[model samples]
Target: MSGSGLSSLAAAMESAVQDAPGVRVQTDVLIRAATAIDHSGPGSPDWRARVAGAIEELVAAGLVECPRTKAGWDRRTLPELPHWVRRSAPPVAAPRMTAKPWHHLLHWVPTVDSERRLSSAERGLLDAVNRWLPAADQVPVVPMRERSWGLLGDDKALEKLRSGRLFVPGRLTLELLRCRSTWPPVQQRVLGAGTWLIVENWSTFESLCTAAEADGFDGRIIFGSGNQVGTRLAALADKGDTPASPVLYFGDIDVGGIRAARLAVTTAQGAGWPAIRPCRPLYELALASPHRLRVQPASADTVSWTTAWIAGELGQQVAMCLTRGEAVRQEAVGLEILGPAPFAALVADV
Candidate 1:
């Protein structure tokens, strides 16, 4: 056998692909196996270059074919792999245990990109959690300070932690530090005496802020910043010395909005807040608004469980929208919908 690292890697790649059913091998599968025997750092540039080079060599030699797409490599139809290399022993087959709770949690969390690539800190946190998950009596806790390498100060990691992932409790020890010098020049209103309201759309957020300020309502509005809510909202709602107050989420009447509401409530509840719910009046208004568009439903494929968690009327409306394949934008409500009086009326009893 050749002594070159690429030679051994190529051989292992061939053997693994040959042993696999249908001669199919995913990029991650090959890279992971190569990492086990290749003796390279997990995400080092040199290691990635070596893997890429070996893959390209295999493609050139007609041993593998990775079709290209406009976006990137198309792994779906990766061509048949050749069985040209020999291995000393067959790959081990282990009994498949039921998926651990963390496995399902990861599916719900947005830790990785479309390519399933994690950042250095995210990978560190995930690996550490995997090691301690089985032995964890309760939620496995990690300090957020610069104690060791893990996803602590990382915003995305904290957001995911707040999403009710029980085995990995990173949100408890996390504190987001803000320096006046490094701030992004965005000014957020400080609440004097009010409940926190998370607004998903930028336009709606601005309108609500204006309305709340003018109406003299005791409601503090925070922007959810689209799909990635980040850690600011969670920090304000969960980490402060102020008393925990009710949380109300107001977004579009579409599936996306419902999902956002669900995430907001779950994160708040996980942080120990007791009263978190969607603004019933705003949600109902969107559902019943006559300004609905005929656009295709964004999340029509799967029925969501948000209906069970929200108020009966609002939840039933969300369920009805899904069943009828309807999506209502927040713009349907317009700026006038949540004017001072209406906004005050929305949360008056809560």
Candidate 2:
């Protein structure tokens, strides 16, 4: 291997070790990660030989240590590298609420077929719900509209499937507090409690619903559905059935999240619902979470309105996330943190 190529391999190994001190990775993984930035194209047999030689150089330089496994060349271990600071430990896998209790809510969520397995995003949504629904629940639902189907970007035909009568049975519906829905009665009470929990992502929404119900939360829950939250929030605000209830929104810690929450509140205000705001407790937990991912930094407009609702330090964290392009996903908060007991304590005043 050339000196520069060896140096580049060493840097990638160092990064992997720093990202996860004791993790194991396949040779392909290391090769792919290295070549991603190198743009030299994944090498062939001669290239593979060069990679192996580079690994030996790293070992010789005392910068990386790899132990052979039964998997042979397929896998290697990286015991923490020298002079590398370990990233924060990953959050424990949060306990997921059982699906038995929320099967009705899964009616509109799609499933895999014989030809293809669930994609990462689909699995992500189902995983949030703990994959407990019947095999029938795995069947894909036709999207009723371009907007309803936008979340599943992979289905090129989803837009074409938009129509009434034919899509009504397959359409997803949200059960609201004190408002009757034409939707099935079984799915009507996803949350029996009166709390209005507006959640961002589908997985987070499903997980929060399961967590809330498990914790005996009787409140109603709504999916923010990305930027579409304003419409949902406005609808709730316009409801005369229930007195304006305190709505607690939980979303990712990023520019989009802040903007979504702000838009929801502004939309609610326009419809005369008491101004909704961020759930501070959730924000505090997100800020301290270990599962944060980096993105492009948040802009001034993203954090401007949200700053008023968040504490000084929390606001600073939001600003920093925007500046550093970091994000704390709502999933990081876990069912235990989002359960009724903590949720109640968090919004008791509201």
**In terms of lDDT, which candidate is strongest?**
1
TM-score of each: 0.48, 0.44
Writing each residue's lDDT as its tens digit, candidate 2 over 1-350 gives: 34444567656754665555355544455665667666664554234333554454555455554543322332221111122222333435443333333455555333322224434443443443333234534444432232233334443332222221213354322211111212111111245547676788887777666766666766777888768786565444435434346777888888788778777776665555665767777777777776768787654334334443553456556655665678888778776666635546654433
* Segments in model 1 whose C-alpha atoms lie over 4 Å from true places: 1-187, 237-243, 295-304, 340-342
The segments of candidate 2 whose C-alpha lies over 4 angstroms from its true place after superposition are 1-193, 237-243, 336-343, 346-350
Can you write out model 1's per-residue Cα lDDT over 1-350, one digit (the tens) per residue?
A: 34433466666666566666654467666776677776654665345334554564455355665533223343122121222222224324432323345543345334433334444445456555555445445443344332233435453453354343323453222322111111122225544567767678888777777777777777567777655453444555443523356667778766677677667665665566755677777777677777655544433212224444443445656655664557787766566876635567765434
How far residue 42's Cα lies from its native spot in candidate 1, in Å, is: 55
Deviation from truth (RMSD, Å), model 1: 18.8
- Residue 191 lDDT, candidate 1, scale 0-100: 49
Error of 2 at 118 (Å): 53
